[model samples]
Target: MIDVKIFQTPSGEYTGFQMSGHAGYAEYGQDIVCAAVSALVINAINSIDQYTEDAFENSVDPDSGSVFFQITDRPVSTSSQLLLKSLVLGLNGIQDEYGKKHIKIRLEKQEG
Candidate 1:
């Protein structure tokens, strides 16, 4: 199953997200769940980079199917916030369609 962690501030603002594991719904190349998750994540990252001035840190591990993206700048920009929110929405939709067996999403409070 794909595990997703969405980090948020006390006031409910998004700060970042981390994703790991494969959907195992099908073979790697044919897993629609994984594809949908990848598309949303990549699009959100690219959109934030291209459309906003927010600074972020990201790391990807193909071997482990792990990805981590964090906004490094404080008081995140509205554009970046919206992009991340869209990502969360897309991910949730995938989870709802594919079921918890394929994907799991959890909300986490950002640590100091």
Candidate 2:
């Protein structure tokens, strides 16, 4: 399963997200679930890089099926947040279609 962890600040700010694990629903390149999730996440990251000045820290390990990301210091730009929201929307759609067995979405709140 693709474990996606969404972060939120105590003040209600969108802190960023982390995605790890593989759906294993199909073969490597032939996995629709993996493809859909990858597209949504990569597009959002690219959009943030293109449309905003806010910097984020991220890492991707294809071998381990891990992608981790979080804000550096500054608040995330509105465009980035919007794109992230859109990513969530796409993820939700996938979860709805394929069920949670393949894609797991988690929300984690920060204390401070």
Candidate 3:
């Protein structure tokens, strides 16, 4: 099971993402989930032509059966938004539990 959260600026400019969950087939494991999320994030970053560097900021284990991923970077265009949505949807579709998990994408602008 994996939970994903995406944050975007109000002007629809910058975006960030956080994903956490279990990776293994029988039991949810952080190692598997971390690797999978890492790959997904990398692929997403590569899909955008304008993005120079999009990488994971941190991966922490606050407890057992849980891992965290923080991805931050600029997206080139609206296409980038659509690409992220699709990527998240695809990741969630991997399992039935994932389908039931809650995923959030929020858009907000930078404060002056």
Model number with the top lDDT: 1
Off by over 4 Å in 3: 8-14, 26-38, 49-76, 95-112
lDDT of each: 0.92, 0.84, 0.50
Whole-model alpha-carbon lDDT for candidate 3: 0.50
lDDT of 3 by residue, 1-112 (tens): 4455655555654355555555443443445444555567657756643453455454555353233333444443466666666666655655333334332223334421
* CA lDDT, candidate 1, residue 85: 92
* Span of ten consecutive residues with least summed lDDT in model 1: 103-112
Per-residue error (Å), model 3, residue 107 = 9.8
Question: TM-score: which candidate is best?
Answer: 1
Candidate 2 lDDT, tens digit per residue, 1-112? 9999988777766667899888888999999999999998888888877887888899999887798877665566677778778887898899999989999997899754
Candidate 2's C-alpha runs over 4 A off are none
Q: How big is the positional error of residue 73 in model 2, measured in Å on the Cα after superposition? A: 3.7
Among residues 3 or more apart in sequence or in different chains, the pairs in candidate 3 whose N, CA or C atoms overlap within 3 Å are 8-108, 9-108, 10-108, 10-109, 23-29
Q: What is the lDDT of residue 83 in candidate 3?
A: 64
